[model samples]
Target: MPKHKEYTILLLSRVTLKAHEFITKVVQSNSAFGPCPEYICKCGNIQSDICETATVAISSVYHQVFKTKTKFSGLEVLGFDKTIITDELLSDLPFRPYNFQLGILRIWIVKIGCSNEITTNLAGPGFKSAFIYQYNKSRALFFQEIDKNHCRVTIYYECNAYIDFIEQNPDLVWSKIGILQKYNRNQLFELTNQYTTNLIQAAQIPYCTLNEWNNKEIITNIYNYHLKCCIIANINWYQFFCNKFEQPNTIIELRSALQLIYPIEHEIGERKFRAWKAMLKNVGCSDITPYEKDQSNVLNNLIRACMHLWTQRISY
Candidate 1:
């Protein structure tokens, strides 16, 4: 590996051997001046950013990075969404046993909203609902062409989403920090997903399935914990279905639809379905007994059971 020089470049990924060669021959020579130029390259005696040779060199390195399909590029394309983020993008990432991939997966799990709590007051208009307040953050890619065959690239990444949210919801103080983190994480994931989805479509794959995140085994205790979180966070499982399917007008209709999609046996005198009904009630699925601790327990139990059942049935 070539040693770091006195350039302002921030290396976000492992430098390849070719990159090392380009940097040594081109970057080192140009930036030898006391002050680092905005961009530099070794060939064509070009010292300014306007050099035609530099453009070609930068393009070459840019293509090489994408051709290797670095994790930075993959994440830039696929997104951090639980379903969209995949290992395919991690193929060229320069780290061993890439924990960054796992970090993205964990964020996806949190974005599931299983542990996200929202009071009536906390239900103020979401960022999506306020277009004027909405924005995205991304890394800016810069290419410094050194010569006809050489150039160096750099990235400027900034996370403005969290700060923006805090600015917009100042009254909430630090209470909105978690909300901002959740939203920003999902946004990054979604952006990556969009980028990858386009690539997959271009490649003409029948369909690109997400990574094996959903297939991760959830132990009994973990499942139980998620259940508690769901209740505490006021997660409305019914809302998940309602968003996908038609919104049911009543609890009976909602229950009927759930049963149709996810069949549950009503054992003789077991009142197995009763608990589910009670919990749904708390989540506004039913008009009766909304927010009862006993009903919550029953609901948690039902959700835990459903976790296993759904894992077996769902593919995506």
Candidate 2:
């Protein structure tokens, strides 16, 4: 393979190994706390905040090692969440793994929410009324993938749903942490494994055939057909739908709709969709609309029609 690819693989391996060691130490050191179920119960109920304990821990380590501020430290980076592992971030690391280039390893920090059933089971029916007992629980998953095919998932960190609960119920901190850690170590492993397996299966499926259409005329026909469906569905044509005209917002909405129709996984489909969008934007069509106005409700009927068409074409 290319030298850069080899270098990336080596760098990521080292980073993963170091990260594991650092997190393990942090968890082990902080795992001991006294118990107090009364204080935990006294906290009442509230929505669970996305626990930043793991993010903070990881960020602290990264900052110390790299001497650079990350998103967790007000770096203002856009990603899925605060604790994401991107290729750009991996490239910043200095270490290189020795003789480890079997395949490319990409690490992703995935946030998995606790199911209502599990939460209800844990807290019991009496505690179920509490908002904290609802869907407040979550776990941070360290998903490592090799060449997008082989994946290894592990629970990197666990946290109580309500941060205040941990604070007020200081004695029960270890118990609370232990609950999630134990559950995640056992039950959640199977859940994440199954989820990862499903993703792998989905990825193995061929890209939708709708993306193969290259003829502009056929594409335009499809667009018009959807427009007609929108009109038939009583969508306000002048107020909502974009036609062959100078409607920038409408064009943007149309592009978004196309994304839902042909997702990013469909590489050729995305290219074709963009090309189609550009064509509609620059080279205005006289055949579709009599006049143009501000775009609104562009998604309503258009989405319905597109989804209908998509469902007919693609099979899971």
Candidate 3:
């Protein structure tokens, strides 16, 4: 059995006098709230945008994967592209499974991204490891106004931990496989606590001076703003796929579309080349063949395929 911990932080008069207004302002400003690639959601482009972005920035998954440590022990939780797991990109795992791996691919759905209840799920199709035991875990956050000058925030995290293995297999040793129950449990607590506290402290800052909010009222899509920041941070690969899209699938045609430069141009080494192929494959591109080179059908498919990732992410 694994442990599930819940943590809470209640900031007293430390918060702004205008609880809802201050939070709204913080949500709109990049300096106050940041977005991580772990969880991205956009729907209707409404008031829920800041909530989604704040939720993502303060999530345990974001802290554990991006802020605290990229890799656990020696295993790389983030794949070659360093993106979080979405329902779309599950098939292209960079490495084969180990006996036990924790937090391999997780999704956090917030506000508009979910229905019924806001939740996060750790289980997905990418779990190809030799299954002996497993744990499905989730952490959720709640916000409240304590008073005119205060706020209350709580984080509830639990794990539906379980295992699956053949009892008759004598060679299956738990000790040798490196289980992450205790390690993950402890790390989740630390990261969740730190992230919550940081958000509180950041919100308490005097940021209203950035710009006066007149009677007209200002509106900004914080979730999309942070998402754009993340995309810009990874713009190279983001643009790479964007550019390669719709072009002929042939290696030469794709190369011309990319207009590769310097080391990448000279060094289409095995790793980089394989990565390109994997990226295309992840985007629903069919198997490329020499004869398939100028087919309009192939071109159309490629165009649609390139938009695969974007369409999944764009505001609905």
lDDT of each candidate versus the true structure: 0.28, 0.29, 0.28
Task: Residues 193-253, candidate 1: write the lDDT tens digits.
Answer: 4432343233221111112113223222222332343332433343433442232222243
lDDT of 3 by residue, 1-316 (tens): 1133221211101112113111111111123456322222222222222223334422323333235533221012212234553322443222222221235523221211111111111111111122112323443321111222211222233534333322111122222224443543222222223433343333322221112212112112321222223222323444444344334442334444434532343434434444444334433344434343244222123324433323332121
TM-score of each: 0.16, 0.16, 0.20
| For model 2, the run of ten residues with the poorest summed lDDT | 35-44
C-alpha lDDT (0 to 100) for residue 193 of candidate 3: 33
Better of 2 and 3 by lDDT: 2
User: Which residue pairs come into collision in candidate 2?
Assistant: 34-171
lDDT score of residue 78 within candidate 1: 20
On TM-score, the leading prediction is 3
Model 3 residue 71 CA deviation (Å) reads: 63
Q: What is the lDDT of residue 256 in candidate 2?
A: 51
lDDT of candidate 3 vs native? 0.28
